[model samples]
Target: MTREEFIAAIAPAAVKLRLEGSPLFPSVRIAQAILETGGVIPAWNNLVGYKVGSGVLTPYWKGRSVNKSTWEVYDGGETRVRADFRAYDSVEDSFRDQDLLFDLERYRRVREAKTPGEQIKALLAGGYATDPDYAKKLDQLTEQYALTRYDKEVDDMLEQLMEQIRLLQEEVRALREQKAMTEIPVWAQEAVQAAAAAGILDTTTGGSYDFYRFVTILHRLGLFDAKGQAG
Candidate 1:
């Protein structure tokens, strides 16, 4: 599949994986996948191009393993090494298995990193990949594909939801106050007219406002004394 098609195919699972609270940013993960898969997506079914060695590649292991020649960088140079890479039944397992990295200290550091760049650096330092330009390549791919768009959209949706909740709460408060203002004694009404005529209330509503508003206005004007009852 084409790059765009490949990304679209995996985007849902990738975003879901990110929501699982993995410290690796979704964008970084996507970029890494793009780099690793590199036109071999369906052939390998390994989304992260996972290497075998965490005890899953032993001869008696129950999972699938594929022998392949990979560029192994060691001692300042690279050599093509034929090794067994773990295979998965589906792309989703490959994606989910990425969490296994958490078992490593460096992977934990990558998650603990405070920024995208730092996280990539942690991955490289932790020997997650051998390429010296691993971080640069991942960073460039992340920006190039605008992979962070998914995370940003999720964040924006959450913010809008919170704002709507806040507005609803305010409306409920207003309605409750409107309901509680059921019994303003006639004496209080007369007091309000007297206060307005005396220009002691801070109102431009022409005395045709809510009863609670009048009470608050008078309270603010010190007409209620300290007991909250108009004196």
Candidate 2:
């Protein structure tokens, strides 16, 4: 497939997977596929960073290696084989498998992230790839392709929610101001009466009948600031 066609085909799938909480970003996946496969070079559809084998040539891979070498073996005692790696049926299947890899239990943290950047960071931090600069590379790809633009709708929703919160706060403040104006005089008279009965206020000479003092006393009694820290 052409480079544009390849990216266009996978972009929707990537966005859907991301909305479903996938750690891998669409741009990163596309870039990696381009780098690994040379954008339709060698006529192989492999896009998941598959490497050539150490031996055991297969019909699918007719190319020869620089030098035949053997690598480590598994517990089954099967000698290491070196040759060209396997190919996939289509790019869509490759992308699907890539998403599945991230959905594994080990990568659960990435799948839980709410944003694409968070998922990308988590994947890099979790050592998902061998590249030491994987995070930087992914970030570059994300910015170059404007992948975060995919979240524009989500950002708009958040902005509307914030506007609603501000309106609600203004309404609350107006209500509180109206209540305070209507109730303060009555509350102040009750406070003076209580202070007089308790001999806390000097009524004989009207000494220290400060309105500010009454207001402070009301505050201390938790009557003025009913909202506590929220106020």
Best by TM-score: 1
Q: All candidates' lDDT scores? A: 0.71, 0.56
In Å, residue 37's CA in model 2 sits off its true spot by 4.5
Question: Model 2: residues >4 Å from true position, as ranges?
Answer: 1-6, 16-28, 31-42, 50-86, 151-231
| Minimal lDDT window, size 10, model 1 | 200-209
> Residues 134-226, candidate 1, lDDT per residue (tens digit)?
988998988888888866755676678799999999999887666555444454565555555555554344332466466656655667544
TM-score, every prediction: 0.65, 0.43
The sequence of per-residue lDDT tens digits that candidate 2 reaches over residues 1-231 is 776666666566655654555566555566555545545533345565544435433433334323223343345344655544544455555555556566568777777776666776777666565555666776776676665565564455567879999999999988876655444354356554555455544434332335536644764575533323211
**Quality of model 2 by C-alpha lDDT:** 0.56
Error of 2 at 145 (Å): 2.3
Error of 2 at 50 (Å): 5.1
Name the top lDDT candidate: 1
Clash list (residue pairs), candidate 1: none
